[model samples]
Structure formats: structure tokens, C-alpha cells
Target: MKRSERLVDFTNYLLNHPRKLTTLSFFSERYKAAKSSISEDLVIIKRIFDETEVGTVETFAGVSGGVVFTPAISDKNSQEIASEIAALMGESNRILPGGYIYLSDILGSPKNLDKIGKIIAHEYVGKQIDAIMTIATKGIPIAQAVSSILDVPFVIVRRDPKVTEGATLNVNYMSGSSSKVENMTLSKRSLAPGQRVLIVDDFMKGGGTLNGMKSLVHEFDCLLAGVAVFAEGPFKGERLISDYKSILKIDSIDVEKRSIDVTLGNIYTEEK
Candidate 1:
């Protein structure tokens, strides 16, 4: 293949397989090019990736060495995306009957989900994240997006158990929004002991559900990598959890007036 064709194919492969190691030999053999040529191509690809703020290409040395692509978005891009989402969420028409904001449209959009995933995945880059965990329903799309970018598996935590999942582990916790006790279940096979799990959710009010997921993580003998949410609403009482990241913060929702105050969340302010 021509150098131009090889560069395009090489860049595509790295982007698709983020965080996965591809040895120089593999690329050399695949492209029918010398290892030296492959190394030179990687230098060009890495420079472009850096300049574009898409991600980073990490190359290692020696016989066992290889290259891995780690996906990331620049802070400027992350801020722009988060700000746009917050603005969209602030529209009066998005408010529901009970002061809840409608986010199905944003979450369902592939374009939006891809951006959201990139922002979230960028935060966890270089961290040891085994899997992305989220509740059933709304959070699935967000988790799936992040999982794809991180090249990891995502597991769903459901309110109701499914027979198809076989044996499950259950945890009961207070509902953040409803203020009632609720049960959440996860398949025992979803996570293994000592795995580092990141908890993700579409929305968080009182953080009770997130707390429950934290407990489930402990139950599985796994470590809590971190918590991330699409948006967080104001809670009347003290929140159950404090250390968490959110893309957007719903400052206030005036149901009667149909107005919402949306702003960027801690995702930007938090230490990198």
C-alpha cells in the first residue's frame, strides 16, 4: 500500500482500538512496511493527534514494546461541549411536570452521546478502570458511549432482577429523589473481585442511587474508581455522596414559570 493509504488505515485502527496495544511488528506486517517506516508513520500520526486534541499515541520501546492510543479531548473542547449541553438543557420546554428536566433527546442523540463519552473518558484516562457501571434505562447510553471510548465493558444495575442474568447480588438503599427505600441488583458475573469500577448515571438528585451502586461495588469486593453523571439537580437535604463529577449542574428549575438554570458542573473545576 502507498504511504498515504497506510497512514489513513493506521490512524483509523488506532482510533477504533483506543487503549489497546498494537506492536510495531503487527503494523509492519500488516502494512508490508519496515519497522522503521512504521515508526516514522506513528510519529506523524501522533503529532496530528496531539495537534487536533483528539488523543495521544503512546509508543514503547524494545521487543515487547508496542503503541497504544489513549482517547482524550482538550479542555477547551470539553468546556464548549458541556456549555452547549447546559444551554440546551436550560430551555424552558425541557422542564417536566415535577420540576424534572427532560434529557432523553440529548442522551439519545448519537452526536451528543459521542461528545459526552469523549469528555467523560478523558477524565479517566491513565486510570485503572476495569468497567463502567450504570443503572438501567437512561444511564445505559452514556455508559455505553464511555465504555466504547475507553475500550472497556459496561455493566447495568437494574431495579428489578432478570432471570436471564442468573444469580445476582442485591443492595437496598434510599431513593434520592423519592426518599424511599429501593433495591438494585447486578449480576454476580458482571464484575469480578478487585476490579476497579466507575459508577455513571444520567441524573443525580440526592445521590441515594449512586450510593447504592457504591455499596454494590463494595459487595463485589471491587474498588470504586469514581462517579460521573450527566447532570445533577439541587437536593433539599445534604447529599448522600459528595465526591462525584457531573457534566452539567441544574441550578434551579421553576416548574410554575417553566424556567431552568443550567451551568457547567465540577467536571471542569476538578483537579486533573
Candidate 2:
């Protein structure tokens, strides 16, 4: 194949199989090209990846070594996406009855969610994440997107127990807004002991739900790798957990005025 054609194929392959290593011999043989030629092709591909700021192509030396594609969103790209979402969140029509912002549209958009996932995954790149965990419904998309980029499994915590789950581990948590105790259950077989878990959620108010998830991680004997949220809203009471990250920080909400203040979160401001 021509070098240009081979470059296209190589780029697609690396992107499709993120985090998986493929040796130089494998690529050279697949393209019917010499190792020297394959190496040159990779150099070109790596340059493009770096220039685009989408990800990085890392090469390893030695007989057993290979190249791995690590997906990452640049700070500029992350801020642009966050700013766009903040504008979307500012829509007046999205205001709900009790000052809640209707974010179903934003969460449901594949384009938005895909970028959000990449941004969140970028934060935990160097960490060990065995699996992604989140509550059922809205959080499922965020969890799945992160898992896809990280090449890991994701587990869901359901509010209602299902017979199909077989055995379950249940926990009670206080509702952030309602101030009522609620029960959340997870399938016993979903998560194993000693795994590192990254917890994600769509929105956070009082952080009651996130706290519950942290407890669940301990109950399963797993270490908490990190906690991330798509958006966090203001609450009258103190947050249950303070060590979490958010992509968008909601400063204020007014039900009567139908307005909200949204801005980029700690990802851009936090020290690396």
C-alpha cells in the first residue's frame, strides 16, 4: 500500500484500539512494508496526533515493546467544549419547576457526551482504573463513554433492586434535595474485590449519591481511583465529599428569573 493509504489505516487502527500495544513487526507485516518504512510512517502519524491535540502515540523499544495510543483532549479543546456546554446550560427553557436545570438534551447528545467522556478520561490517564462505576439512568452514558476510551468495564448502581441481578449488595443514602433516606443496590457479581474504581455522575447537588458510591467501593474492598461529575450545582447544605472534580461548575440558579451561571470547572484551573 502507498504510504498515505498506510498512514490512514494505521491511524484508524490505533484509534479503534486505544491503549492496546501493537509491535512494529505486526504493522510492517500487515502493510507488507519494511520495518524502516513502518517506523517512518509512525513518525508521521505521531506528528499528526500531536499537532491535532487529540491524543499521543507512544513508542516503546526492545523486542517485547510496541506502540500504544493514549486518548487525550487538549486544555484548549476541553475549555471550548465546556464553554459551549455552559451556553447550552444557560438556556432559559431548560429550567425545571424547582430550579433544576433540564440537562437531558445535553447528556443525550452523542457529540457532547463523547467529548465530555474524553475530557474526563484525560484527567485519570496516569491512574489505574479497573472499572468505571455510576448510578443508573443519566450517569450510564458518562460511565460508558469513559470506559470506552479507557478500555475498561463499567458497573451501574440501581435505585431499585431487580430480580435479574441475582444477588445484590444494597446501601442506604440520604437524598440531597429531598433530605430523605434512599436505598441503592448493586449486583454482587458486577464488581470484584481489590479493583480500582473511578466513579462518575451526571450532576451533583449535595453529593449524597456520590458519597453512597464511595461507601459501595469500600464495601466491595475496592480503592477509589477518582470521582468526576459532568456538572455540579449549588446546594444549601455542605457537600458530602470535597475531593471530586467537575467539568462544569454551576454557580447559581434562579427559578423565578429562569437563569443559571455555568463556568468551566477545576480541570483547567487545578494544578497538574
Candidate 3:
């Protein structure tokens, strides 16, 4: 095949398989090209990713050489998005007793969820994200919306064990916000080893759930493309994981005042 055609298909594969490494033999088999030619094309593709707002392309070297991409969204975009979501959170109807906010409206708004999903998908546009993942019930919409943008499978992690269509994997977790032990499960066949995964959720409180999801990703022996959330609560103080993005942070919610203070935090960070 022509060098141009080879590179085109090569980049496409990279975008479709984020953290996976493609050895010289794999490329050689796919494109009928020499290892050296594939390597050169990969270098060019990696450089291109570095210049875009979309994502990262990390090239692994040596015997198991392949390239992996990770999304790195800009801080400006993240802040702007947070402001939008925070404003929406201002709906008086969203208020419930004890300062808890109801997100049924946001969860049910496919159009709005589409926008949020697209914004995040744009950040990982060209990276291969095997499946978009989130916890069951609450996170299904976000995961579905994002999966729509990326055109990948949407995997749901269930809060309780139930019969699912495919294989299953269960996990035990401690929910940070509620300070309660919880369980989450995913279809065993949903994710593959070395696949790239993008984690998304509607909101984050103390990051306990995200931490549990992180553990599942690790267990799969795959790489985390990144984590993204719409709103982050004030309780997320010094969690064990890093490299996450949230549009807004809730500093305080005055139950009596019926007010929620919103600010922005690290949606963008230095990547080594």
C-alpha cells in the first residue's frame, strides 16, 4: 500500500484503540509494510496529536512497540463547561431537603447530555477509547452520551449485582460521599486487556466511586484515557488518584439560603 494510505489507516486504528500497542508484525500484517515504515508513520501521527486539543499519543518502544493516545482537555474549556452546569444547578426545583440536589432533569435531558458528551469527546476525538464507562442507573446517560460521540460501546458498572447479558466482574467499594460500603460490577466481556478506556460520570463527591472505577480499570490491565465529570463536590480532598477533570466545584450549599456556590478547579494538569 501507499505510504499515505498506510498512515491514514494507522491513525484511524490508533484512535480506535487508545492504550493498545501495535507491534511491527501487526502493522506488517495489516498494511503489508515494513516495520521501519510503520514506525515512521507512527512518529508523524504522534506529533500531530501533540498539536491538537484532542488527545495524547504515547509511543511505546522496543520489542512491544506501539502507540497509545490519551485525551488532554484544555482548562479553559473545562471551566466554561462547569459554569454552564453550575448555572443549571441553580434551578430552585432541583433543591431538596438537607441540601441534596436532584439531577433527574439533567439526567433526562439528552440534548444537554449530548453537548456535555461532545465537549468531552472532542478532547479524545482521535484517540482510541474502547468503551465509555460509568456506574449504573445514575451514570448510564453520561456514558451513553459520550459513547455516542466516540461511537464506541458504553459499559455500565452496576451498584448492585444483577443478571446481565454478558460476562460479569464484581467489585467492592467504599463510597466516599456517603461513607458506606458499596458494590459495583461490570460485564466481564465488556472490556479487553490493553484497551483504552475513558471514564465519565455525572458528578463526583469525595471521589470514592471514581477511585473504585479506577481500580477496575487497573484490573483489566488497560490504560485509563482520563476521567471527566460535570460537577465536583467540596469533599474531594486529596484523593489517591490524579489527572481528572471536573467542570465545577461546589464550595458550599446553604440549605436554608437555597444557594450553591460554584468555582472551578484542575480540569487541566501537567502530563509527564
Candidate 4:
């Protein structure tokens, strides 16, 4: 292949496998090029990646070394995206009867999820995340988004039991939104012991559900890598989770007036 063709192919290959290492010999053999040539191509690719803020390609030295592609977005880009999302989410027409904001459209959009996933994945980059865990309904999209970017499997925590999943481990906890006790179940075989799990959810009011997920993680003997909520709404009382990160924060919701105060959450301030 010509050098131009090889560069395009090499860049595509690395883009497909974020945070994965591919040896120099493997690339050299695959491209039918010399080690020196492959190294030179990587330098060009790495420069493009850094300049674009798309991601970074780190080349390690040694027998066990190769190159690993890490996905990243600049703080400025992240803040811009978050600000746009906050404005879009604050529309009064999206308010439900009970002061809840409608976010299905945003969550369901592939374009939106793509940006959301990239933003969330960027935060957890370099962390030892084994799997992404989320509840069955709304959280699935966000979990899938993050997992896809991180190149990891996502596990769903269900409110109801399904026989198809075989045995399940169920945990009971308070539902922060409804203020009612609820049970969440996860497949016993879905996760292995000692895995580092990142819990993600679409919306959080008081974090009751997220807390339950944390308990479930302990039940499976897995470590809690982190917790992330797409958006957090103001709760009546104290929130159960304080350490979790949120993409957007709903400061106030006035049902009568149908107004929402939305702002970029702590992730932008903390990370950026």
C-alpha cells in the first residue's frame, strides 16, 4: 500500500480501538512496511490527534510496549457542549405534570448520545473501569454510550426479574424520586468478582437508586470505580450521593410556571 493509504488505514485502526495497545511489529506486518516507517506514521497520526483534541496516541518503549489510543476532548469543547445541552434541556415545553423534565428525545438521539458518551468517557479515561453498570430503562442509553467509547461491556440492573438471565442477585433500596422502597436485580453471571465497575444513570433526584447500585456492587465483590449521572434534579431533602459527577444540574423546577434553571454540572468545573 502507498504511504497515504497506509496512513489512513493506520489512523482508522487506532480510532476503532481506544485505550488498546497494538505492537509496532503487528502494525509493521499488517501494513507490509518497515518498523521505521510505521514509527514515522505513528508520529504523524499522534500529532494530528493532539492538534485536533480528538485523542492521544502514546507510544511506549520496551518489549511489552506498543501504542495505546486514549480518547479525549478539550475542556473548552466539553464546556461548550455542556452549555448547549443545558440550554436545550431548560425549555419549558419539556416539563411534565409533576415538574419532571422530559429528556427522552435528547437521550434517544444518536447525535446527542454520541456527544454525551464522549464527554463522560473523557472523564473516566485512565481509570481502571472494567464494566459500565446502569438500570434497565433510561440509564441504558447513557451506559451504552459510555461503554462504547470505553470499549467495555455494559450491564443493566433491572427492577423486575427475568428468567432468561438465569440466577440474579436482587437488592432493595429506597427510590429517591418516588420515595418508595424498590428492588433492583442484576444477573449473577453478568459480572465477575473484583471487577471495577462504573455506575451511570440518566437522571438522579436523591440518588436512592444509585446507592442501591453501589450496594449491589459490594454484593458481587466488585469495586466502585465511579458514579455518573447525566442530569441531577433538585430533591426535597439531602442527596444520598455526594461524590458522584453530573453533566447537568437542574437548580430549580417550578411546575406552575413551567420553568427550569439548568447549568453545567460539577464535572465541567472540576475537570476543566
Candidate 5:
């Protein structure tokens, strides 16, 4: 194949299989090219990836060394994506009763989900993450998108236990929004002891649900790597959790006026 064709194929493979190591010999053999030539092609690919701020192509040294692609989005791009989402959410028609904003359309969009995934996944790129965990239903897409980019498995936490799950672990947590106690469960086989987990959700208010997931992680003898969410709304009482990240912040909602104030969340403002 021509050099251009080889470069296109090489880039596509690395992107589709993020975090998977590929030896130079594998590419060399696949492309029917010399080792030196393959190495040179990697350099070019790495340069383009870095210049575009899409991700990083890491090259390992030694006999067993290989290349791994880590997907990332620049702060500027992250800000742009967040701002766009905030605008979409700021519309008066999106405001629902009880201080809630309509999010089904935004969360359901493939374009929005892909960009949100990249922004959140970029935060935990180099961290040791064994599995992505999220509550069942809305948070599933966000978790799945991040899982795909990180090339890691994602597990779901359900409100009720299923017999198909076999042995399960359960945790009781206070619901932030309703100020009521709630129960959540996880399959015992979903996570192993000592595995690091990242918790993600579609929306957060009072952090009751996220706190419940944190407890489940502890119950399973796993470490909590971090927490990320698509959007966060104002919590009247003290929040259950403090340390977390969000793509957009729902600053204020005027039910009477039919308006919502939205802005970029700490994920964009925090120092890298």
C-alpha cells in the first residue's frame, strides 16, 4: 500500500483500539514495510495527533515496546463543547416543573454524547481505571462512551437487584433531591477487590446518588478513582459530596420567569 494509505489505516486502527499496544513489527508486517519505515510513520502520526490536540500517541522503547493511543480533548475544545450544551439547556422551553431542566434530547444525541465522553475521559486518561460505573438508565450512555474511548469495561448500578445478577452487594444512601433514603445494588461479579473505579452520571443534584455509588465501591473493596457528570444543578442543603467534576453548571433556574442560567463547570475552569 502507498504511504498515505498506510498512514490512514494506521491512524484508524490506533483510534478504534485506544490504549491497546501495537508492536512496530505488527504494523511493519501488516503494511509490508520495513521497521525503520514504520517507526518513521509513527512519528508523523504522533505529530499530527499532538498538533490537532485530539489525543496522544505514546511510543515505548525496548524489544517488547509498542505504541498506545490515549484519546484527549484540548481545554479550548472542551470549553466550546460545554458552552454549546449550556446554551441548549438555557432555553426556557427546556425548563420543567420542580426546578428540573429537560435533558432527554441533549443526552440522546450521538454528537453530544461523543463530545461529552471525550471531555470527561480526558480528565482520567493516565489514571488507573479498571471499570466505569454508573446508575442504570440515563447515565448508561455517558459511561459507555467513556468506556469505549478508554477501552475499559463499564458496569451498571441498579435501583433493584435482579436474580440474574446472582450474589449482589447493596448500599443505602440519602437521596439529595428528595431528602429520602434510597437503596442501590451492584452485581458482585461486576467489580473485583482493589480495582479502581470512575463514577459518571448524566445529572447531579445534592449528590445523593453519587454518594451511594461511592459507598458501593467501598463495600466491594475497590478504590474510587474520581467522579464526573454531564451537568450539576443548585443544591439547597449541604452537598453529600464535594470533590467532583462537571461539564456544565446549572447556576440558576427561574420557574416563574421560565429561564435557566447555565455556564461551564469546574471541569473547564480547574487548572490542568
Candidate 6:
């Protein structure tokens, strides 16, 4: 593989698997390259990430040397934990077809969304979170719930710029499945500089929307307190987010049986 391509792939692998590091020898064997070459690649990638204020690359030196990506906030420590996620995911639900699932009921129920939202807000209760963001079609209600509990503002990420909006910014992200770039937009004045934000969504399929939201937050010169998703979909191959929380992880949706399988996500245990 070309050096440039290998570097890009290496970074993607780490970003997709934060806190999971593979040794240099592993990469050396996989790429059939010298250890020195791999080391150079890691340095280049780490520098690029730090300069952009995107990610952090830490290298453990010694007999079991490896690299790990540690996000400022990890899902495992979110107000909600993974074991709790499994319990919620245990319930079955209706699946229409083509792997598409309808979750309108969950989003609309204030009580249900409230419990989940509060769990997420609890983590940022004193973090000075300025607002919550969610991408429309499905995430609006959940975002609103979290915003209410946090007593903060809420911003919606639109699929396209509406005529009524005065000014907006657009960002392109790799769709979770297709890997094709899609556009999501938000009003320019929604988030202010030096503001802290908590990103919330109804579902996290591929984290494409999360990445887009992160980019949008960056454009507004805001800081991200964290991200929380009601449910996480399968396919955890190349995720763009690191610090996040998910209540449930759907294993499978049995459309014919009207049942669904789910598991717990990262839950916060320590007192924040």
C-alpha cells in the first residue's frame, strides 16, 4: 500500500476503535513494513490530529508497546452504562422492513425520553453545557427532552438549509453505511464561541451524523461536553466519535417476530 494511503487507514482504524490499541509489531506485520516506518506513520498521524484539535494519540512504550486513542469523555463513563443499555435493549419491537426500524413512539414519549435524557444530563449537570444538538427527522424529540432537563438551549441540524433561515453552515460527513459524503446544516448563530455543548440523538447507526454535528460545533467555535445516543445500531466498523454515551445497543431486529435484541452501553458509575 502507498505510504499515504496506509497512514490514512491507520488513523481511521484508531479513531474507529478508541482506547483499543494494537502494537507496532502488529501493524508492521499487517503492512509488511519496518517498525521504524510504522513509527513514522504514527507520528505523522498524531501530529495531524493534535494540530487540528481533533483527537489524541498516546503511545505506550515498553515490552507491550501500543497506541490508544483516548477521548476526553468515554461512553463507558457516561451517566448511563453499558449494562443498563442491555436491559433496555432486551425488549422487542416492530420492524417494518429492509432493516428500517420505526422509533417514533420512543421519541414522542416524554416520560421515556425523559429518563434517558436525564441520565445523559446528569453527567453534564455542572459542566456548563450551553446547548444540545440533534439532526432532524428522528432526533428532535429526544434532543428537546435532554435540553429541557439540562435547562439549556437546543439546536436542530437540518438536512438542508430552509428559506426562512438567515445564515447557515453546512458540513459533509461520511454516511455510516454508504461511506458517501452527505450534507447537514445548522444556523450560524445557534452556537456561540467558547460555548460548551452536549450532543444528543435518538439513534446512532454509524456515527456519521455525530461526526457532522461535531464538525458543525467546531465551526461555531464551541466545545463539546459529550454525546449521548438513545440506541446504537450494529456495524461498529469505522466510527468518527470517541467521547459518547449510548443507552441501548441493538443486536438484531426480528421484523417477522416483532421482536428486537439489545444490550447495555457505557453507563456512568462514578459521581460526577
| Candidate 6 overall lDDT versus native | 0.74
Per-residue lDDT tens digits for candidate 1, residues 151-194, read 89999999999998899999999987788999999999999999
Q: What TM-score fits each model?
A: 0.98, 0.96, 0.67, 0.97, 0.97, 0.64
Residue 205 C-alpha lDDT in model 6:
79
Which scores higher on lDDT, 1 or 6?
1
Q: If candidate 1 were superposed on the true structure by all CA atoms, what would the RMSD be?
A: 1.0
Looking at model 4, residue 114 earns an lDDT score of 79
Model 1 clash pairs are: none
Candidate 5 lDDT by residue in tens digits, 4-98:
99999999999898888889889999999998888899899999999998799999988989999989888788888889888999999998888
Sorted by TM-score, highest first, which candidate order results?
A: 1, 4, 5, 2, 3, 6
Q: Which should have the higher lDDT, number 3 or number 5? A: 5
Q: Provide the RMSD of all predictions against the true structure, rounded to 1 decimal.
A: 1.0, 1.2, 6.8, 1.2, 1.2, 17.7
Clashing residue pairs in candidate 5 (N, C-alpha, C atoms within 3 angstroms): none
Q: Distance (Å) between predicted and true CA of 175, model 3?
A: 1.9
Find the 10 residues in a row with the least total lDDT in model 4: 263-272
Task: Rank the models by lDDT, top first.
Answer: 1, 5, 4, 2, 3, 6
Write model 2 residue lDDT over 159-248, tens digit each, in one string: 999999989999999877778899989999989999999999999999999999999999899999999999988878788888999999
Top candidate, metric lDDT: 1
lDDT of 3 by residue, 1-272 (tens): 99899988877887776445567688878998888887788778877876764567776778767666654445565456656776888766676897788888876887778667766776665666888889877878888878865667888887776775466777777877777888888878878899889998877877889888988888878789889887777674565345677655677777787787766535533342
> lDDT for every model?
0.93, 0.91, 0.74, 0.92, 0.92, 0.74
Q: Which one wins on TM-score? A: 1
Residues 54-134, candidate 4, lDDT per residue (tens digit)?
Answer: 898999989999999988888788888889899999999999997878999999999889789988988887889999999
Candidate 1 accuracy as lDDT? 0.93
